[model samples]
Target: MRETRTMRPRAAPNRLIAAAGLLTATMTTVATAQLLPGVPASPREKGPDELARMSLLPERVGIPVGGSAWVLVRLAIEPKWHVYWRNPGDSGVPVELKWTLPAGISAGEIRWPRPEVFRTPYEITYGYADEVGLLVELKASEEIGTGARSASIRGDWMICKEMCLIGGADRTFEIEVSGAVEADATDSDRVPITDSEAFAAIARWQAQVPVAPPEKMKLRQMVEFPNGFRADANENAGVLRLSGPAGRFSEVRFLPDATPGTTYPEGGPVEGRVASGRFEVEVPISVRPGDALGEALRAAGIVCLGNARTDPAFEIEVPIGPPTAGGSTAP
Candidate 1:
């Protein structure tokens, strides 16, 4: 099978100027949505707006000064239609977020939930189905006064099923800022008094966020390519041996994110399997010549156990040291 990568389009210079003006002026709520050309909506499928509904939900009733408040960018996707994840695997663009925040307030990166794997004969992708909530923490400066602040966010995504449709929505929110949080208050006490359902939804998605592997389940090293990794080596193929308790998981898979100047071979022997008390995955690494390497020397991906949505997943970064002397390939 051939691997294909999909990327989001860039705006022209004129469009960039117009967008900058729009962002600086006022963020108008775009009620309607637009579909990308060529890929028409199927008769059985819903329209762009109907396919995905974007809304904002706050974790607390008021933002605490000198502290951060969590707000969820909830996407209620129609059944059978899905939105891409941070990696988006072999194809598709991940959902993008653009925020217009009040002065003295800043937005944090979206904490992505675990993504489901979607595979077909042509390509493999990772994304979400049904409802998915993305948590974005908004931080306020200590000098900011207590009052109500207005903020707006826009979400752009590519929802696909039998056909793909690019769509976006704008959501406006009024955030209430208060004094510093009390030192005696417990974690639960800081939760939103209102929006019980929203808080629960955020908590649910927060639980799905991938975390580091436990101490007992840490990766030891690569077994097959012990001579060290060479980005310029011929047919750079090896096995990533993860030492962990096995037999508990029936399936194992690796969903790779984008790494500049490097690529992972897809399909064929390039897959993962569980054996003994370890999870071993065959990784075929290829890289461009004379590449300026820094973080690119390390391989990063999500190691999924059993079912991606329901089972436990761990985020791993394997260091690829320099090749053996003379920059030779592993025998």
Candidate 2:
């Protein structure tokens, strides 16, 4: 309850490093939008249904190893207007967030919710449609209480439609040491084992994230898969089945799917084109436990792409498990 707080980490590392690593593939989208004359712009091609705004929420409040205070970054949108996740799908660019803070304060990484597919005959995209808040977790420096700590944020985002529209703002936000509130610390039983109070308070953020791709995968070889990839939707499981080699996993996770409840920033349906030996599948699964996703599907369900093996070229081929009575993985 009374942890020590320290200075915040510089956002440059995340901007130059983490952010760069996540958005490399997006370069193609920028290059595709050749600023030429008479491109036959379709309805402002980049015109948006609504404007997007960003703010912070106390709901994700937390105190880390240090006495630092943390909060959530909330991105609100007008109806039907969506934004891209860190890893944007095939045809769109990602929304980039840059935070500016004082010496003692620091910010956490942006958690990406799984994405809905945005399909076009040519390209598919991954992003959110309508109202959703992207949780920007933060930490206040321990020194803030002793002295003073503050921070500012500069975010850049490109909201897209049929064509891409780039929009960014250098907005000023603050986080200084404040007096303790009246909330009571959780008792022994109710308290979480490992910062559950912090996690539970923030876990609500999970609500807005996209459904994660399957963690368990058995698919064709890398050399044989197609660039466009293959997809099969299993509404019964509320999951999209992607067919691709281990390396192709990254693309699938970023691209959009056609699930009903899901939404994508780029307009249109996903393009399906897989190489002869390689195929990629995208399935939608409820990240939370005990959902309505069919039982049979759940038994053999592959839920998320773990950090260790989430790369586009990543691969995992389990030796065909010992043959079962039916010679198949139970479904």
Kindly list the per-residue Cα lDDT of model 1 for residues 17-42, writing each as its tens digit.
33333432233445455555775657
- lDDT for 176 in candidate 1 is 61
Full-model lDDT for every candidate:
0.66, 0.40
Give the 10-residue window scoring lowest on summed lDDT in candidate 2: 24-33
User: Which ranges in model 2 have alpha carbons more than 4 Å from their true place?
Assistant: 1-50, 59-65, 68-70, 78-80, 141-144, 178-203, 208-331
User: Which predicted model would earn the best lDDT?
Assistant: 1
TM-score of 2: 0.45
- Report how far residue 49 has shifted in candidate 1, in Å: 1.6
Off by over 4 Å in 1: 1-45, 59-61, 189-194, 216-227, 230-239, 268-271, 275-278, 289-296, 319-331
Each model's TM-score, in the order given?
A: 0.76, 0.45
Clashes of 2: 49
